[model samples]
Target: MLRRAPRECGSWWWDLDDVTETGLVPALGTAARMAAVLGKHALLEPSSLEWDWFERGRGGLGVHTRLGLMGSRLDDPELAEQARACRPVGHPAAEMSALLVTGPGERLDAEGEPRREPRLVELTVSPDPYGCWAEVAVHHDVWSPCDFGGEPHPAVHANNAPRLAAALRALDALLGVPGEPGEPTYFGVAEGHGLKAPELVDGLGPDLTDLL
Candidate 1:
């Protein structure tokens, strides 16, 4: 089983308010384009989508929905309609909030064998009319220079960080908007197209295994 961090190690956000329209259809379109770039880099394959519903003034209704792709691509013309049809009958006024795109992501294991890990890279897009944005986040330590135990893992970092950076660069080019580094966490921080190196202490990075 894959060990996932309780919170994201690093995240990147893209404000698409100017470039993309805000709505279910347009959000899905953006997700399709973003997923394509991630898939090309073996980051996310987009097998399903999950979201919560909210009303303009009433806030969240605590209602959540999940839709399995069942081999349907995110770009499929029918996907947006299928998603819209899932709205709760009790909350007709509710609108979709941020939609989460999930799928198996490729990760090299202890022996360097590629393994499919679910939710390896999480992608979310907000369809709110007020403002539109998208975010990509990673939890595992593969993108970092050291493991949770403060042990250096240059090989793992080399193999994974570049792929994630390339994917982010591709996403920037595709969306025509540069990604902004998200907030820092105890685990790590996002810098440029990759993670910012944690401050070292006596030649070792911070031991974050306690949080893990």
Candidate 2:
């Protein structure tokens, strides 16, 4: 089952042309826990590997992929063991931009240094363009003022606005935490998977509209 922490990051993300229908995806079965909210309701439960999303640069975008707090939490033994068993998302990566990171939180070096800033992401999962879909906790920090080892995708600041708005909405719906409604990139977007916003009264910080 997919593991989720109630007190952990509250967030969401998705593709450029996708929408709620396409965004409502399956969780990786390997997820030991998960929390989801549809409409005005909330649901937290065990997840499956089938819910995972694949990371494929299609050999150009940028350094793409993710490592959660669960990754370094191996000292706990229980989570480390489970993280090692994570299953591949298996979805076709044929259309992914260079390196796109998904999920919440910020990037860290081996010594736990802030690798770079954060970003609000947007993507189109299919070969054919369409409406928006799905939401992710964090995404590729391409827009940050960091080096992508000299990659080929656009920087994070160049991200589309509509897509970011959609991602924020998705996260708010699932996490059930609204952001401080305001302009785009109010939080600077990137920082790994930053699901919980500090601007929120409940400590979740900001509403999805906060970024609009």
Candidate 1 pairs with clashing backbones: none
TM-scores for all predictions? 0.95, 0.21
Question: Over all chains combined, what TM-score does candidate 2 have?
Answer: 0.21
Worst 10 residues of 1 by lDDT: 107-116
- Local accuracy of candidate 1 as per-residue lDDT tens digits, 73-132: 886879988999999999888899899999999987556678788899999998888889
TM-score of 1: 0.95
Off by over 4 Å in 2: 1-135, 143-146, 149-156, 160-162, 173-175, 179-212
Error of 2 at 161 (Å): 6.8
